[model samples]
Target: MAYDSIEDLLNNGGLKPGDVVSQRELMEKTGATLGAVREAIPRLEAEGLLITLPKRGLMVPSLDITFVRDAYQMRTMIEMTSVPFAIKHISKSVIAGWIDWHNSAIDHLDRGDEEVAQRLQRLDWDIHLQMVSAIGNALITNVYRVTSIKTRMVGQSRIRVTPANASRVIGEHLAFLNPLYAGDEVEATKALCQHIDNSLTLALGGTL
Candidate 1:
């Protein structure tokens, strides 16, 4: 709960990268007990989500170029490693379902449904998370979870999704999903790499 509250602050722009706040302030803002907030701090710091300054307060990570690049690079490495396992083990039905969800999400976004847009973002992460989990390694999955959070933070700080770009994003998802559904290992891997590269560019404030 405490960790989620802090993530909510970051995602909602209540807290930003490089912002510092005292322990009491965090407790108040998150509505968590001081002890709970304190307990959550070390985990967050370990994940590179935030850090403690000598006497200043807890500071969120600054979104510098190197930071963004490293986060996405780590993401690419972990995800690319998962691709073989995902392609081999993930069901065709599941891939089809994902393709359907992306298509539906695009339609909802076209209608200006903010709720669906938010859900679509979650689904985007879920798809990647599912791929990583397909490897069946708890340790790597845990590491990927932390990387995902950092990547999402970078993306939220930099990318603003408009209808035009949202459709484009879904299209990118389809680019890989269709090949995966067809059991084309080579094509799937290539398309997934391209999609991740596109995402990295967007996270770094580049256009598609």
Candidate 2:
């Protein structure tokens, strides 16, 4: 049997931290075969998204704030170090696209659409990743992408987009994007540092 889709099980808020769900119960609810359910549980466990008890079976994992902070810190270092190189290699069109994205994000904020606003927020972050990847370091890009996904998951659990905060975030992103578009390597690096610093500050504050 194939592994059960973990995303499916996470629906409806039924799986709480430390609340175990036996294999039989999982199978009954998901219609997933026993073999599939068994295989998927361990994967989730290894990812720190789930845990298993000796007799009670598997449950969602508890949030670890320390791990979240450490993850953000690690990502900040990796992405920041990539910036100077990215500024050197990134294209004019690419930088312009980033500016466009930030401008569009601002529009979303003005409209007060929280879901779209949140999505635009993530895309704004991706602008930095795209810049990094353009440095043509496959190994660095791959490693950072893995950590990025983890950070995003942790962020989703903790952050919600409000109109006020979204507007502020859009402003912050433009501050970073403008320097990069002008090919101002020194200022671009500074902007990236500030952007990462603000994010680290928020993550440490448990505001994600």
Candidate 3:
């Protein structure tokens, strides 16, 4: 419960990168007991979500060029490694379902349905999680989970998915999903690489 509250804060922009927060502040914001907050600290630190200072409060990771690069690189490595396994193991029906969701999401975003847009964001993460989980390695999945949280933090802090760019975002997802659904490993890999590169470019504010 405490972990969930922390994640909620992170996702909702209540907690941002480089924010130093005390335990009592965390307890108040998350509505978790003092003991619960303390217990969750070690796990949060272990996952790279929090850093303990000598005397100051816990600090969220700062968003820097290096941090963004490393986070995305780790994401690319883990996700690319899972592509082959995902291609072989993931069902065509599941891929089709995702494709359908993306298509619908594009329409909803066009109509300015922010609720659908939010759901689309969750779906985007789910697609990646499903792909990675297909690798069947608990350790890799666990590592990916941490990497994903960091990547998400960077994205949330740096990128804003407005209606103008929402379609492009969904389109990027389809770039790989289409090929994967068709069972074309080479095309899927190429498209996935391009998509990640595009995402990184956007995350860097189009500088890189």
lDDT of 3 by residue, 16-134 (tens): 88999999999999999999999999999998899999899999987677887987898888888888899899999999999988887776787888777667767777888889999
Once model 3 is optimally superposed onto the true structure by TM-score, how far is the C-alpha of residue 107 displaced, in angstroms? 2.2
Pairs of residues clashing in candidate 2: none
My TM-score estimates for the predictions, one after another, are 0.86, 0.67, 0.89
Ranking by lDDT: 3, 1, 2
Candidate 2 lDDT by residue in tens digits, 1-208: 3343454344224454446778878777777788787877766666565667777777665545686777777777777777777777777787788678767767767777778665765576567678768778888786666455455455553343466677767777778778877877778777777777776666556443
Q: How accurate is candidate 3 locally (lDDT)?
A: 0.83
- Residue-wise C-alpha lDDT for candidate 1, range 82-142, written one tens digit per residue: 8778888899889899998887786678887777766666677788889999999999998
Could you tell me the TM-score of candidate 3? 0.89
Model 1, CA-based lDDT: 0.81
Model 2: worst 10 consecutive residues (lDDT sum): 3-12
lDDT score, candidate 1, position 143: 86
